[model samples]
Target: MVQKIGAQYLAKRFADQLMASPEPREEPEEVVRETTEVSGDLDGQIFHDEEGQPIGRAYLVRQVEVYVVSPTRAGAREELVRCLNEPDSRVYLREVDGRLSGVVYTPDPARTGERTGAMRADDV
Candidate 1:
């Protein structure tokens, strides 16, 4: 049987692979911010799409940065965008070794988010 690895290691490895090459940065998706628009007495009126076309209901968006991470050469890519007035250092991260990779949101305000398993020599 193969040995199992931990997220700390995988996350670090993934981060390193992406950061190693800074060129050809892909475009990041914009974040959407939803707000209620009153047409008459409606407080929770339905929202529209980015094109102002009615989509039944919609909301929210952000950032001007694309921080990408992929597990395989052809694996799915996840990106994090920089919120307004947010630092570019803000990056997307995944530490779990599950079949599907999802961004692991952290409330840690500190920029320590960047230091993952492989991100630090000590983590290795």
Candidate 2:
């Protein structure tokens, strides 16, 4: 017999895996605040952080594969973008069947900028 897991269980499992992973090296504060524009399919308005600093405006680039685990590929892509826009959420990417899939977890509601209407790339 097979067992089915709820979304909450899956979420917790993903979070636990993330907690067990290595930490990423931190970048200097100035570098993180630099502003740059993203063009093409992923287009949207820009917004600032609580300190009036521009958000999502860094020039230093790194490749990231965002995955949203859903029943449909389209749903996964949509969820990925939604999670990316959340200021306080930590996104975790994992490889499944040779493709990268991601799970977003928000550990702190206080840090979440949901009320501020942070920058978003919904059109992507």
Candidate 2 residue spans exceeding 4 A from truth:
1-47, 50-52, 55-57, 82-90, 93-124
Candidate 1 C-alpha lDDT tens digits along 28-91: 6985666444333433457677998866643322222223333333432322222323454334
Tell me the TM-score of each prediction against the true structure: 0.18, 0.26
Each candidate: RMSD: 21.8, 23.1
Model 1 residue-pair collision total: 8
Residue-wise lDDT of candidate 2 within 1-124, one digit each (tens)?
A: 1234577788899999988868898967764545355443234445578998878743422333334434456666655565567675565656568665543443235543354345669854
The true-versus-predicted C-alpha distance at residue 37 of model 2, in Å, is: 10
Error of 2 at 99 (Å): 16
* Candidate 1: stretches off by over 4 Å: 1-43, 58-79, 82-115, 118-124
Worst 10 residues of 2 by lDDT: 57-66
Report lDDT (CA) for all predictions: 0.45, 0.55
How does residue 35 of candidate 1 score in lDDT?
Answer: 42
Give the Å shift of residue 119 in candidate 2. Answer: 41
